[model samples]
Target: MLEKTGVPTPEQVKRAAPTEDRLKKGPVAVVECFQSIPCDPCQYACNQGAIKEFVDINDVPIIDHEECNGCGICISQCPGLAIFVIDATYSEDKGLVKVPHEYTPLPEKGEVVTGLDMAGNEACDAEVVKVQSAKSLDRTPVVWLAVPHDCLMKVRGFRRKGGAE
Candidate 1:
């Protein structure tokens, strides 16, 4: 289904998601990479060593949720845009999701944007909390959004209001 639609099935997403207990612990990286491509930047970007070393160059990443502090350093390093950091404990009603943004005119902090699901559908309204575009990120900017707690997993991307894509 993923090869046909470019969107991973729900079951695949479940397998990539961290456990409920791990989510409650705080922010953690969620590697949604399912394909076995020759990629390992996420593992190398993790200073905490949370992303396990690849046994093979094409092996999918294995994240040690306990070791990840959810700093989101790996978010931008992932060329495939498969890495994200979720902070469920950010608030009782909201959660923080850090996603990669490669488009021009990035969303500004405090701006309200339309959160999107895996299939690029509208999921919810999210507030931009932070935008990290350090030179160290290699030009991939990471946008932090605060969305409803219920949409923590659903909101994977966002569309800036009246902004060019």
Candidate 2:
């Protein structure tokens, strides 16, 4: 049920990965759903219809990555917190990532925090670019972080200052 390192397997990543061409178009959502759970919020959250409607409630989502504009809507709508928005074109030296955050003491905009990877390993320092908590989000805060361009793909989330959750 897990990859060699006890996380998502290579096949799972491949299934959820967007095409390199789509990624080059700018920021896009990456749905990391490896299991076929009965979920579809991501599909409807995408105003562009980039996430296809599931034939069955239990079916996994398929991304039309080209249609994705990286609006970061699906990031807060996903119940599994599996959707990530990556923008490699944010700048020449930085990248942007929008991640779902449910923890307390949410980092403020412009604040610096430690970035962590999927396995909770420290990746790099990240700056909070924006914090979206619109009423439509239903309590799930979507945090946007600016990280080093080189660590863009490696960063999955952020940690509070002083190693706090």
List lDDT for all candidates, in order. Answer: 0.90, 0.85
Per-residue lDDT tens digits of candidate 2, residues 28-145?
Answer: 9988887777878888888999999889999888888888999988888899999999898888889898899999888889999999987888999999999988898899999999
* TM per candidate: 0.96, 0.91
Predicted structure 2, TM vs. truth: 0.91
Clashes (candidate 1): 0
Best of the candidates, lDDT: 1
Segments in model 2 whose C-alpha atoms lie over 4 Å from true places: 1-6
Model 1 RMSD, rounded to 1 decimal: 1.1
Number of clashes recorded per candidate: 0, 0
**How many Å off is the CA of 147 in candidate 2?**
1.3
Residues 62-159 of candidate 1: C-alpha lDDT, one tens digit per residue: 99888888888889888899999999999989999999999888988899999999999999999999999999888899999999988988899999
Which run of 10 residues does model 1 get worst, by summed lDDT? Answer: 156-165
Clashing pairs in 1: none
Q: Give the TM-score of candidate 1.
A: 0.96
